[model samples]
Each structure stands twice: as C-alpha cells, then as structure tokens.
Target: MIMPNEQKAPLVHLANAIGTMSEVSSRVGQYVLANPEKVVHQTVAELAEYTHSGQASVLRLCRQLGFKGFSEFKLALMAELAASERSTATDSDNEADRYGALLKRLTQSMQKTAYALHAEQLLAIAVHMVKARRISVFGSGISGLVSQLVSYRLMRLGLPAQAFQDPVLAHEVMTDVDKHCVALGISESGVTLDTVEFLKRARTAGAKTIAITGRVNSPVAQAADLVLLAVPIEPLTIGGDISPAISKIYLVELLAMAIADLSHAGRQRNERSKTP
Candidate 1:
C-alpha cells in the first residue's frame, strides 16, 4: 500500500517543476494516460475535477507535457481525432461516398489548421492584454466575429476592450485610443482595407498595436507592434468558409483563457499587497 507521503511526492514534484514532463508528472498524467480517449473532449476544469486535482494543477501538467497550455493540448487531441476519422468511417460503401469523403477531408484540414496554431504567440497576446490600458479589436467578415469574442472575453477579465467591426467606428476608435493603449486587429487575409487603415492610425496615435491574422506578411501585420499568425486554411469550395471561421474562433478562445489566467494572477498579487 502507498503511504500518504508517497502519494504526496508526485503531486509535490509536479507542483515544483511542472514545467517539464518526461512520461510522468503526477496522478493527472497517469489519469490521462489511462483515459486517452476522454482527454480529447475534456476541459481543464473537467480534467481537474476528474483527477481530483486543482485546475491550476491540470494547467501545470499540460505545461509539463510541453504544451503552451490546456487549449493546445486539446487541439492536439482533436488532430488525433481527425487522423482517425472516427466520425466518418462507416460500412456504407454507397453512391454518397464522395460526399462523405469530402466532409472528412474538410474536417481533417480544419483540425490540422487548429493544431498548427502557435501557442507562444497567443500567450504573448495575453501578456499584452494584461498590461494595456485600453484595447481596440478590429476585423471584417467572419474574423469580425472572432474580434467580438476576444473583446467580450477581455472585458470579463476587467480589461478595457472594444470590438469595432464597422469601418467608421474602427477609424474613430483608432483616432481616440490613448497613447498607452493597445489595439488588436484580427483578419484572416490581413489586408482588409479598413483593418489595415485602423491599425496604421492606432500606431500613428502611439498606441501599441497587435494584429492577429493568418497572413503575417500582410499590411496590417506590417503596421502593428506585434503580430500573432494563425495557420491559413481556406475552404476548397465556395460555400465552405466555415472552417476558417471556426479556427479563428478557437484561436480567440485560447487567447481569452490565457488572459484570464494572467488576470487572476494579478488579482492575487493585489490582494496580497492589501494584507497588512
């Protein structure tokens, strides 16, 4: 039988340098290994509750496993799902096989795009959000939806953020953003006329500007203080623009979670300072 001290050793070790993992970290790792299938769909909070560990512990375990965090880990698992084609493979060798194959290919492509995201870049954006006095987000088309989501998440974390999808509003916001504020522009092509103009204006106004786009070499990226590049995966057909939209939304969610983590850490620090 394992003693209490023995049981605590793994957890303690994980708590200490959970930044590195080599086949083992804590009970969390053991649990994930045992239930690999479940890890694909589980959230950090769900995984923590499942393993009887804290949410932070789960995040630390993911970091130890060489992931930027839990979101990247989930993306990796989703890629595995795409590779296996668990949802598409069936015994129906009928005439509709062409459509089935196309659907499977599209899903796989989108999953690959998501898996290709750079976690470090998202984390860097989160760090900028934590320090910026104000944030203006801009995008057009589906990317506009992503910008709105990012702004909403940042606001919940107590950051001053606004999503300006309308060209007029974007220009107006850019003109008035404080010099110390940060402007984040989102676009898949990175060449959206309005987005590029707003980013340029924000930079000219002395605000730190960031561009989240699939095209790192585009004009919007060229004018920003920082650029977070998402992997580009446009649709193969005219009516299939949903894949890139979903990928962009996923990227926004990951950035939001990272910012939330930083915000919580800051709150802790402020509370500690108030303790006399």
Candidate 2:
C-alpha cells in the first residue's frame, strides 16, 4: 500500500533538510511567495535573519535544491524572478527584447538541469538499455515526443526499439512484454493515468521498467524498476508557449546522447566476440 506521505515526502524532506541547518532556509520559500519583488535582491544573511534562521541553513537549503552553493541558488532564484517579471510586465516590450528574455530563462533552466543530472545514474540507464533484448517506450502528449526521441536513438544504435503514443497500443504491447524486454515511460507531472497504467502492466508482465519524470515522489516513480528525476521548477513563459517545450527537449536530448554512447560501445563488444 502507498503511504500518504509518499507523494509529499520529497518536497518535505527538501524543506526539513535545509531547515535543520538554518531556520531561514525553510522560511525562504514562504518569504519569496509573500514578497516576490525582494526575491531577486535578498542576500543569504538577510534572508536568514528575516526568517530568524542562520546563514548556514540558507546555504544548506541551496545544496538540498541541487545547487553548488548559495550563490548558484540565488542566481536560479533571480532568473525565475526575472521570468515572472517578464510575464507580468504591463509596458509594451519589443519582440526582440521578449525573445532575448525568453532565451535567457531557458538557458538558465537548462544549466541547472545539467548540473543536477547524475553521471552514475545515466550510465546505469544506458547499461540497462544496452543489455535488454527489446525496448518499448510510452508517454502521452508532450512526453510522448520524448518517448519517440528515445526510440529513435535506440534504433540508430541498432537496438530493437518501439514507442507507442496511443494508449491502446501501449496496453497491447505491455501484455506481451517479457523479462528480456524493457519499458521506458516519460511523464513530467508523473500522474498521467494512462502512462502509469501501462507501466504497471509492463511490470506485471515481467519487463524491466524505467521512469523519467520531474517528481521523485510520484506514483509513477515508485512503480518503475528505475527512476530518473528532473528537478521541478515553475513553468517558464515566454512571449508564447514554445520555450518550455524547447527547454524540456534539451534535457531529453542529453538523456538520448548518453544512452547512444553506451549502446555503441556494447555493439562494438559484440562485433569483437563474433570475430573470435
């Protein structure tokens, strides 16, 4: 049975971890919500004292959020603030300025994401994909696109790969998946009913399953054999809806490249064995 706190634990742990060292770190989130304008300019000590916490706690909070230190966290917080400002700006801004602002926001998000990706976790995923006899990927909507990209990269490396965007097809495939097969599911929200059901079915059928999603505490993550989490942040808005998709694609591309490199090495090893 799933525990009630299971869904909330990651965020709660994040808060508690920082709070343990400094009371200010726990309060920073509340402070930012109440005083959005000050978020961009508040120093660590100021934020700590304001929350009746210590500077050490503030730094610990930043680390828990996957930043190198307080300065990096401050930059990310400031970037989010700037994006929020651009979204709410009333004055007419030029098209070029808007585009530039959006670009900056996306770049910042991508940088943070790159920093959070664990090399060991990536290598483990690649190894699993390389060893599996067949691979199936599933997702819906935007995440379906990511699934397709994963399938495409695996196929290019000469592996048997397939992606199902349709729920019916995904369910059909899951029924026959075996121990030699692997299933990869991508979902940012981690609560997509269709995707979760398909993954559950795949696992029941004895296939190894992996999940790539934003929330570590999500049910989808709990159901998979392996879970890779993308740290969550506020949705980025540019002049339109394009930037968020582009930013997500950048991270997906990195995942694909890592798998491809590992698959290629596996193929080389197989060729040498056949020759001997």
RMSD vs true structure, all candidates: 13.7, 10.4
- Residue lDDT tens for model 2, 152-186: 86797777899999999899988778988889888
Q: After superposition, how far is residue 230 of candidate 2 from its true place, in Å?
A: 3.7
lDDT of 1 by residue, 209-243 (tens): 88877654467777787765454542233543645
Q: Candidate 1: minimum summed lDDT over ten consecutive residues — where?
A: 6-15
Q: Which residue window of length 10 is worst by lDDT in model 2?
A: 1-10
Tell me the TM-score of each prediction against the true structure. 0.59, 0.64
Best by TM-score: 2
Residue 275 of model 2 has an lDDT of 100
The TM-score that candidate 1 achieves is 0.59
Count of clashes, each model: 0, 1
* Model 1 pairs in collision: none
